[model samples]
Target: MPSSGETTTLASGHVAVPLEEEDEKRIFRNFPTFTDGASRLNPGRWLLLKGFKDVADRIYNFKLRESDVVIVTFPKSGTTWSQEVVWSMLHDPDLKGAPRSPLMDRPPYLEMEVDQWPTEVKFFVPPLFQAMCPGGDASRGTVVQMLEVEKEPRVIKTHLPLSLLPRDTLDKAKVVYVARNPKDLVTSFYEFSRTIKRLQFQGSLAEFADHFMRDELRYCPYWEHLREAWQKRNHPNLHFIFFEDLKKDSVREYRKLAGFLGSKLSEEQLARVMEHTSFSSMKGRDEALGKSDQMNSEGSFFRSGQTGSWKQKLSHDLESKIDAWTKENVADFGSDFKYFIS
Candidate 1:
């Protein structure tokens, strides 16, 4: 609950409030002390990081067009990979029209408010990157603002759960939700939290895993998020993609994605997309675009994009704990769900 003077009214006439610390702890009893430069907000059933409170209402009410396509996923769940594949299929099927601009700008992240950070704490956005934003100045406009002015058939990206998005999101737009095994997702999120300056996470993987299992991380209650989408797995407008499946056979998964998005690419064109969206190619592009250099990251944005990489990272005890967590949570999803965790 937010007390008086603790809420801000956004320009959209939406009153936004971060959840009180007491409420947060009450809900996530095992909340840890690893401050990620943001508080938690339960705008609806989902828990989002602090910045989203400001624009959650705006996003929910924003008009969406039938031609629009949104890539939805939990963080570190191969979101960038899906974005690249979807964007390429829609905007650059021939592959020659692709821009050299960072993918962040191409299929802009709808909830990215990095530009709104206080000047002293803002992560460095290189001049070139800033220049490439929809407006020449990144600080001058929010990503949502950019999306508002974007042309039709827009390719939008977001980590917000389906419930937090526009009321008519599924009705008006095609959504591609990417899911990854919790084991790999948490491991990647741990590495990512350490790399991003904003998170300032100094904890070990085990500590991070504790936060994860306790549902204290941003966009957490991971099983619930997946379950929501999984239940709607038959929605006419929604498509599900698994990171492991993508890793197992990118060409096959990509072809399926292309078909779902109604893009009919020739085999040659499909091959071009496969090559461009490959992990190595994407890593090289990110490096060339300086994404890896930002936030004082010790590792590149694209680490080993391999299935089962978690075996190398998680200790036996942690693995057992995650396995039990997965088993308990996914039991309701039916045995078919085993394919994702397997």
Candidate 2:
């Protein structure tokens, strides 16, 4: 493995460097068994795939445009759902022109790099993505490179915390962050980890929760991620959303999102977007596109999209442990923060 700050020239001719290891001990210090393929990025100590090491500098220095709309979220926090809603608001309000292409192809993930994976692991990548970004092919370019050539007013998606983004991102772009209750988020993420072969997570839900609480999972230290965005909630260009709010009343959230993007949607258009992006609708779409097969997961990508569904899955002891952890971390975040856990 490359050491911290080691630079390498990728096939795309882009010079990339690994994240500087500020505290090696804290990087995957716990749960070394399950975290074999992950690493920590400096400054925030954010957990991410080892591939992020190759593109960290590129993402930090990425240029942003004023018209760009970036969707930021921790993994499995309704990212795909928000992407669909935001993309529709900006590009197809009427929902008539929405493309049949998968959402992953629509808003390019800012830090994704499939080329760095081992040859044995490469087969796990979805075929659609393989075709779009064939491994070791400089002509197609990395995801960040693809973003550079995309048309203006692009809608970009990322799981990166605010600290890793371009310094001028907020000044140059509109950012929408969606937060989910940790209970549901963790439940969804646990299921997702099991589905993705690359993660290599074979533990029980309880063990996964322990890792999550310890900030060992990818894009973890979950509360810290939320706190960064919470501090910047007042910024004019940053729009903060709760995943529960969308589940409770998507129409209202959709309107608020459209307004944030400065798009005026007629009632008909709003209804169309809501209908098209609903969880059931998206799941159906994913099935029609055979995304489940492509993902190599046993179930559909869009699992149950219910709020507070963790109550059904978590044991009493596990729930209490999670609650205590939540209380301790969010003590200083104010009462409004309770909305996320409640």
Candidate 3:
């Protein structure tokens, strides 16, 4: 077996093996874990994947270039949608070519634990790159190794809070942070929890809502996640976007995204991008860009994509709870952010 922190060269490329059991235990002991039902929250403060804390560490230290564009979001807050839009904007301006491959295979999830994700979530991992090292099967590659194989100007995705990402890379890379109203966010997350194997979420909507308010859900303390990014909103390289804003005027938001990336799109090109990235078209085909395990199990991920679908799903009392929680947690943000004030 390879030593810890050692990389083994594969027929395709180099991939790192898992740490020795004792070393892994020592490393993970520093982080906290939470549990509900059979779900064991392995360490990381945000976006808790079952046993992916080590991968999170790898992502935190992953070498980043100035040209890299990173998409950061709390889970379910338009991650896939934003990813598709950015991917197209950067890679396929005309929308004329066939997808080079599934979006996941293209941009790659920075911290996705391919082995930990549900079995149904399949993508074409070509043999050109060895995703993970020896122990992992060829079809299931490690996120880190896959990312290492990518070329520059790469678009990466992550759910980690700003504090947890690589400090050196934070100021160097163009970071796009997207958020949604907590009500819709919570509702969507509740439905999403049901579809993931690791969440082990066996509870009613109200129960899950309670978990949400308490910050017990994965990638949680929604307010804190926003707070960290909000404080850094003015960073020259960081961009803040809202789901409602995107829903209200996708063209304008897409234009802003294009501008941030220093790319120019004509009226015709922008319209084509808007049409291709629309929730309807995205939902109807390619399984919402084929980036989510939840979508693979749930069959469809494009549920109502409206600005305020939470009005129907959340009970009056639960809505009151969310409102109060939002105000209390994000009081300092004032009314600048639409989600808190709306």
Candidate 4:
């Protein structure tokens, strides 16, 4: 068995063995599990397998470069928000003016499953990226489009754990990891879990806590993934930003990001990015309301976009369990992570 902190060495030596567990394989076997059935609440019409499935092994794999930028974060942890921020930092001027690119194309999501829309909902989102940029380089491929890719100065997004990515991705690429308070994560996850295809029903909040505590969900054991990037925070090419930090001082946060990306923006440009990238403003835009990222979603992928929202939904009893579970599961157990907010 691999040690907790061990970096997996693949047969090729350079490649790494991704941290795959039984639950992930199980979820792979029975994907698109349910849609508003007894097992699900936030349901989708169709679910397609990207990784751990048939084609992605060859299709989704990509070789990143030193100039590439990757935004890594746990699911629903301000992924779209961070993507928007990073995109605007580099391309704000271009995006702000006419012939602009939507958030997706300028800085795309790298490895997660692409959400395709149903025919009914598809009409709402008009290829926000393809239309906005329409740059000659844009290729409309599946998750695999990035496979074997060697894009310089590229910016992409991903939700996969650090162990799964190519070893040099960070070494070669600028990596930005976004983390949120576990309470908010778990709070968002409860609703997001309702959308996942497989899992045993634990009950309302308490029921799910058991699975979460046990790390039963695919892309789970969130703390380990968090630490994987957290440990690398000091790396030359890495930056880890907290959701709370952005929530507290977004204007300043954008400036910090602009600086990281080697772009300097005036207060006016920063204000515009902050305005459009604001959750409420983006929510009003057609893209998010329609799952503009292309995952055939019926509802807003950016639904109720905010921080500390977990408080409204998580039970006190469940919260206690989650706090304990997070402490136990975090890689260094009281050393590496700051899971609580206030």
In order, what lDDT does every prediction score? Answer: 0.72, 0.73, 0.67, 0.57
Alpha-carbon runs more than 4 Å astray in model 2: 1-37, 98-100, 114-141, 288-291, 294-297, 339-342
lDDT of candidate 3 at residue 99, scale 0 to 100: 46
171: Cα error in model 2, Å: 0.5
Scored against the true structure, residue 1 in model 2 reaches a CA lDDT of: 45
Steric clash pairs (candidate 3): 47-219, 131-142, 132-142
Q: Positional deviation of 103 in candidate 1, in angstroms?
A: 1.8
Winning candidate number (lDDT) = 2
Position 270, candidate 4: lDDT: 80
Name model 4 segments beyond 4 Å from true: 1-61, 98-106, 113-141, 144-152, 195-203, 287-299, 330-336, 340-342
The true-versus-predicted C-alpha distance at residue 157 of model 3, in Å, is: 0.7
Residue 181 error, candidate 1, Å: 0.6
Expressed as tens digits, the lDDT of each residue in 176-277 for candidate 2 is: 999988988889888876655444356788988888898877687798899999999989999999998888878788889889999899899999889998
In candidate 1, which residue pairs get closer than 3 Å at backbone N, Cα or C atoms, i.e. clash? none
* lDDT comparing candidate 1 with the true structure: 0.72
Per-residue lDDT value at 127 in model 3: 45
Q: If candidate 3 were superposed on the true structure by all CA atoms, what would the RMSD be?
A: 8.2
**In candidate 1, how many clashes are counted?**
0
Worst 10 residues of 2 by lDDT: 115-124
Question: What TM-score does each of the candidates earn?
Answer: 0.83, 0.83, 0.77, 0.70
